[model samples]
Target: MSPHDQHETPGIDLARLRPWFAEAVPQARAEALSATLITGGKSNLTYRLSDGGSSWILRRPPLGHVLATAHDMGREYAVMAALADLHAVDPDAVGLGGFGRPQSFLTRQVARWRKQLAASYTRDLPDAVTLHAALEERATAADAASRPGIVHGDFRLDNVLVDGDDRLRAVIDWEMATVGDPVTDLALMLLYTRLARLVGPEIAPTPPTSSARRRSSPGTRPAAAATSATWASTWASRPSSSPRSSRASTSATWADRPSAPASTASVAERSTWTWATVSSPKGGGQWVGPGQDRVLALIEEVGLSTFKTYVDGKSIYLRGGKRQTFAGAVPPMKPSALADFQRLAVKLEEMASTVPLDAPWSAPRAVEWDSTTFGQWLDANAATDEAKWLFTLAFTVIQGEDPHLSSLLLILFHIAGCGGIEHMISTTGGSQESRVVGGTQRISQEPAKRLGKRVVLSSPVTEIRRQDRGVLVKSERVTVRCKRVIVAMSPADAGRIRFTPHLPVRRATLQRRWHNGTESKLFAVYDKPFWRDAGFSGSAMTDLPVARFVVDNSPPDGSVGILLTFMGTAGSGPGLTWSDAVLDDPRARRDALLADLTKLFGPKAAHPVRHLEQDWAREPWISGRVSTRPPGLMTQYTDAVSRPVGRIHWAGTETATVYDGYLEGAVRAGERVAKEVGAAL
Candidate 1:
């Protein structure tokens, strides 16, 4: 019986099975048997043998000439027995025929085919010779002591059957199984997964290539020979056979099977590809380290390309590539206002550079200013100070006028004492508290509690939509449904969350127009608070540092504390020794920062206890500092910022037009959104 003969063989008739059933098992008389040819094997014939009441699988060697070492039915039976005893095989699934039981008709046919196939092909043929060589190599490797196992030569999806629920019902065709290196099984499984997409659920009858056949043919058994050599060497050092115990140990090989879920399978496949690529000598080894090499090897073996593709597609670099150029190209400067703003920007930069390196009033100070007094200070200093002037200019360019300095000042004067100036004076006059300006109490610390809880932090949310019963927050995690969500984030964060049932077009439009003030903040903790004693306040608006303004963080008790600094705009560039490249390097970042601090606060500020920096550009959750509108955003999006979208409402600093990027804006947005949600509920 050749391979073709096995396929063409007629199945046993159920009607004629009565006599066989009477002799074999009288209880099986009521059962009928139907044989269906199973596909997916190159070296074996497998069939689904269904009795009237139950189904069983039959497996045997392929039709035609077979190699001496190929299609070992005994080895297959041993592996199945081990797996079954371990309960690794699903109980609902059937197993191979028991030892001593009469073989099924299908099995007899398969044996006949194996005999025929063995004689059909000659060793002279190139394909046959290659196939034999491959098998020899595999057998030699399998025989190595360290690689001992009952190897499953082929374990592709097509060889396995699943029930309606997608549970593995049976694994068929074990003719190529052998007691040898277990890694052979792993290699076969990996190969199967790679070819699965193209080959479908069934295993293909042909080898991947002639070379593969030579490497994998059973008679050659090169892997087995290698395994045997290793085993012999080990035994030479400490002699022991212990065949039974060694066979029992093979059960541990299947331990990994149950955990091999579909997702894991996909990841495994991708890892295999990545490993192959990286391990290839053509790819430079410069980037390969010990850990990375191991990872690449595993990835190659497992074929992890799919997972890698998914991750790369969602990275910040790809997502922000196009948007990063927006600020440079657009400049956010209107055509009519471009010249004036450009001139003001230059003047402000020059004035900032000319400011004294040391100043008494420049240090960080506590201020308790009413809105009116703050407004008065702004009015008095707006024109003289370059920083304030540039701010006002930018505001005027974006907004038609500065309402805070104009209309809001009058309101503040009526309600409190004087306008912005008086308010600033009052706040500055307040007694200095502990050095740290914004303590833990002032900042939300909820994140601290969620640590180590599988939190998905830092990933930017692309969109949010409302579901039937709850809201869906979509991040890298699949859509998460939440009944109540705290949008206690930035306005930019709020704007990005897409709502379902459509947020009113007005609200969506408002969100796009609102801007989170893009500013950079830096904090440097020095060895001691030395600047205060030198009559130099910690705060200064200077061109020496990247930040336009710095705050003195010296404690009243004289302990070393943090000095906070802020860049008024995103385009400050680098200050002193701080180049763009240095700022990006973690170690250089701190050094560059300290270099600037020393310039402003004198030599004593050269070394800091710690350095902390924040770049709003790369921060996903809070893309920018707070909301700073272009001149007209307030009139446009102010009313709609906190408006409700069906049951969902918006909240964040950007949503608050009154104090857009300030802490006050956050509070305002929160209060307003809470009320809106309350009303909806």
Candidate 2:
């Protein structure tokens, strides 16, 4: 065959391989070399090179398509070179300190498959999403419990070269080799044995038959038993094929395929409570959480209530220091003031709607939006001070910051395309509509109950030190070591903890600059929903300095009446401010709050059986309620806020992409970080 005219091996260049091989192996010389493609290997291509006198094997990535991290020729070569010293090899003794990042290697492997699966998604198949999710959930603990070693990513009969006597010869196909839990290699080997039963013995190798081989295999029964039903279903779900080529090929098998669903759907799709579609982020999916609200689905799977049932079309707002009862979110404004506010709201909404939730902070439109503050936008658009005050009252409570100091991009994120604040609250089912059945506290307590003794109480972590293999977390009562740590508090609170090696300058700056909004909640409990009896929804938005907004926190049965007050000090210029004297004294604060309630609800609001106040600023662990960003801060370090610094990951309401200052944002951030840490584990 002419080297130029006829090419048998698809990826191998005959003309180039001959001279290159001669140079690589200088002792071996040949005028012409013949190459033949080797079959059986699925991921990286293998070829047999013969110069008549000597033969050698050559491997390369498969032709047409390649999965990320699945094919690394250099990594394959490194593993082979490192294993050459196995007879007397000590990874540290050989100066291979940076050989591979062993920390969270198994978790990374699981996450790698998840991302690759999402990238190569075609159509949904049974057990694909479920199996992948289960693996991710368990990956962290699995990595923590295991020892790290060079993992042969794919360890099976086809990838190994054996002698005629069936004795070991050499292990090939090192493309997927990496520093990870060595048990993965054992698991995959055993899984292949299991696959033989599902795909038939012809396609997969049989289990060990010889006594020596059987004995060498580490207690086969328990390992196979531990593989679980998910592993079995993983093997039986779908055929291995390239979605891009749509060709039947075992290049990627059911045993090793990605399992994430292709579609970008959200929690609303699976929610039992009706979620308004307009309130959803741009892609109709949450900015965080598993692809289709799987994190939320897990909460439900654990038997926790996600949302509550509420009477439809019931809302109230306080305007001009008057109690105005409204069916929806239309806060009572003077006719001219309302008209002026609409014009400004429409202008800001138009600009904000252009920025999608998933758009990069550095995107052109995003950059433009961040270029100005909400105050700047209002200054240019609002015709009257009343219009500006209306904007302030609505957004300040939602965002937990003075609008002048907030990026226009931030304000737009909440109100974009949903009209302004009024439309977002009422038409979109609003943020304030639903309450968790028992209270939000149940969400945290339920998980702790399941964890039992593992969940340590009164152990507040004060320091996190990065060790060579993992992190050491020191708390008041206990110290723990982990491969990866997720800091779920606000950036401001995280600043209180000492980091041994210290954080990157950009990240440290973010923590230092992450200021909190001084916000507090006050709840008044009464015998009945008396405000409801007067044809009021028991919800009010007030311009009062002490009580900013009020909502009905009654049980579904309406057995007791509870009015929850959201109070905060806002504004840099002359706008609204919380009374410091009232906040300092409990009795004075209660008196002032009740007085405001009396003005809004009537004389019946004067007495309450119980009044509970939560001043977030006074909390030891939490210095403030929600995080607020200054005008230019987000533009400078938007990516750095959530980006992992080595083994540490950031999670909190502030780190979320959608609803960044709300409880929903906190849940989403937790979900996002859980997946992030799980992947690395």
Candidate 3:
């Protein structure tokens, strides 16, 4: 019977499947076919397809959203069903000699899973990174000790089919099947049995053990029990229901399965793609230790604060008015004026919504947004002074530039499209929710410690030149040659490097044009968190010239009080006039900050014990904190930002497609370049 004559299956396009199935298995020539949905895991949709005399299994990605890498039917097909009798067949003898690259298989597996995990990143998972690093470090040794063979990636009791006589019939669900260490297959099988016991029989039902000691299972195997235990704990917090690519939310209950335990569900809904069974090359061993390394694991490991952000303490100060609820200046101004401001804010956001966030850079809509400045848009749309001042303050505080200089598209992308005012202000679990116990200096310091002498401290690279099969990097004190180099710096810093061949005209021009925002950080320390007693969150926004943005920077214990102030050096922001003089003179800067703090949080703010200041613009090598694309720049040559140039690859926050100019973006960029370089090698 034709596919059109058959009842439609939710996932199967029967019309396409029938012909393809017929071609792949020509012996199954029965005219009629039927497919029944198989009850199973949420990762892939499986169906039992049948002709009158024969039945076959068909699997594909989940219905609504599919992560491309997670469900590869081609990968499963490559191993073939005939090889499922792993105990009886030899792969090389069966014309499967070129099935997979077995060299350094363990090392490659570590890198492959790390890259995959990066793809599905929702938030920070330090355990994932640490686990990856540990695995990678041991992979080389592990590979050398192991013998390569056709490995069944996920060998378990459930995955194997048995005849009525209780003899081995066939193994199934070979999506992760590949040529690698045979021990990995045996290990994963044992690990599953262990998981069944540890997580409880209800969630992970298992068959009776071969041993007479019923309590003893594969988990008790001494060979790698310690490693397996660690791996199990790592996975216990990970959601196994979803594929590597699927952005499975915690709220999404798995279909045809019991709900995951609260301990696992509460930790993270999304899987970190740590199957550790992928087949790919170990991303090359060229090491250039540039610096060091967030979310929950970071907070615990680094001893961070969990202070609740107080909305009452977060006040917005207006000229000649008392500080009030940060509700867009409602208390200080008339209701009608505040109402106009609120209306205009919503109107502007709605206008920005017209332009899609993911529109191509070359699209007319994107071009229009990129070309128009926030100031220009305000002049046309914003009706009242209240609207103009509030919008401008929010934009300048968040973006580190005045509305006149920043692109409307940049604002829309970072502000309206991103999350709106709440995100910018750092509400609970927002960007500014917590601070590392120590300064972020520890981020670079920890990695530098690991790298030891490999990290050439104070040695700045001045030039880079392409050589035979590699590139030459020259620093002030040392020079090195490597196969490829990831220049993990902002465009401005990258532009300072003298390339021997001179980068492409567009690339060079882009680097030169990519300027940094004049943002500076200031910290005022005191005896105790006095503002908390005063019903203040120690967070404030003002039109003050010295400090445009303020937040509580106290330690987790609250033993000492601190107020972090963000000031801009130039443009139409409030800090434009006072930033220069204050940044130059230490005393004047502290005095100015205290004056503003006092005005915002009362007299107690004036008597700080210590002051700390960091003007990013004045910092060496790192000219600024973040790269800011100006009007017309992002659209003009943004293509060259991430596009590789021969052996030279780029990995910076700016090159990231998501959360660009942030730490998260930087990590994502590093993972992307690692994969690119690995493939190239």
Query: How close to the true structure is residue 290 of candidate 3, measured as C-alpha lDDT?
Result: 12
Give a tens-digit lDDT track for model 2, residues 1-681.
465427556877677666666666665554567766655555566555566666555667778866565577766666565564222344555455467778888678788888878877798754467667656645664555566666667766666543345444455666666666766766776666654333321222233332112011111110111111100000111112212211111111110112211211211122121100000011001111222243355446667553443334455566564555567556677788889988886776676666666543654577776778887778777888878877776666655556776777767765642334654444234444445556555555576456443344434566778777777666543345556767766777778788989899989998888777666678888899788887777766667767676767778788988887766654336546766767455556778988888887788788887777655554445656556666667778878888988888887667777766655566778778777876776
lDDT of 1 by residue, 345-452 (tens): 454334333222222012122111212222244455443343344344323222122324222222222122111222211113211111122232212223212222
- Residues 1-681 of candidate 3 have per-residue lDDT tens digits of 586446788877777666766766677653566766655344455455667666655556567766666655566656654353553356687666677788889888888899889988999997587667656645664675566687767666555433344443444555666777877876776666554443332222233343111011112210111111110000011112312221111111111112332332321233221101000011101111111132333334544333433344445554545566454323355566678777876765665556444443644577888888877887777667666766776666556566677777776665533455445444453544444445544433454345333333334567778766676665543345556767777777787688988899889999888877677778889999898887777766566767666777776678899888777666334323455666555556677888988888889888887777655655444556656678898788857888888888887767765555555456567678778877876
lDDT comparison, 1 vs 2, better candidate: 2
Sort by lDDT, best first. 2, 3, 1
Candidate 2 weakest ten by summed lDDT: 275-284
- Candidate 3, poorest ten consecutive residues by summed lDDT: 275-284
When sorted by TM-score, best at the front, the candidate numbers are 2, 3, 1
| TM-score (C-alpha, index-matched) for candidate 2 | 0.54
Candidate 3 stretches with Cα past 4 Å from truth are 1-316, 325-360, 571-585
Off by over 4 Å in 1: 1-438, 446-463, 467-486, 543-547, 554-558, 568-596, 656-660
The superposed Cα distance between candidate 3 and the true structure at residue 150, in angstroms, equals 77
Question: What TM-score number comes out for model 3?
Answer: 0.53
lDDT value, residue 153 of candidate 2: 77
Cα deviation in Å at residue 334, candidate 1?
Answer: 33
Tell me the RMSD of model 3 versus the true structure.
26.3
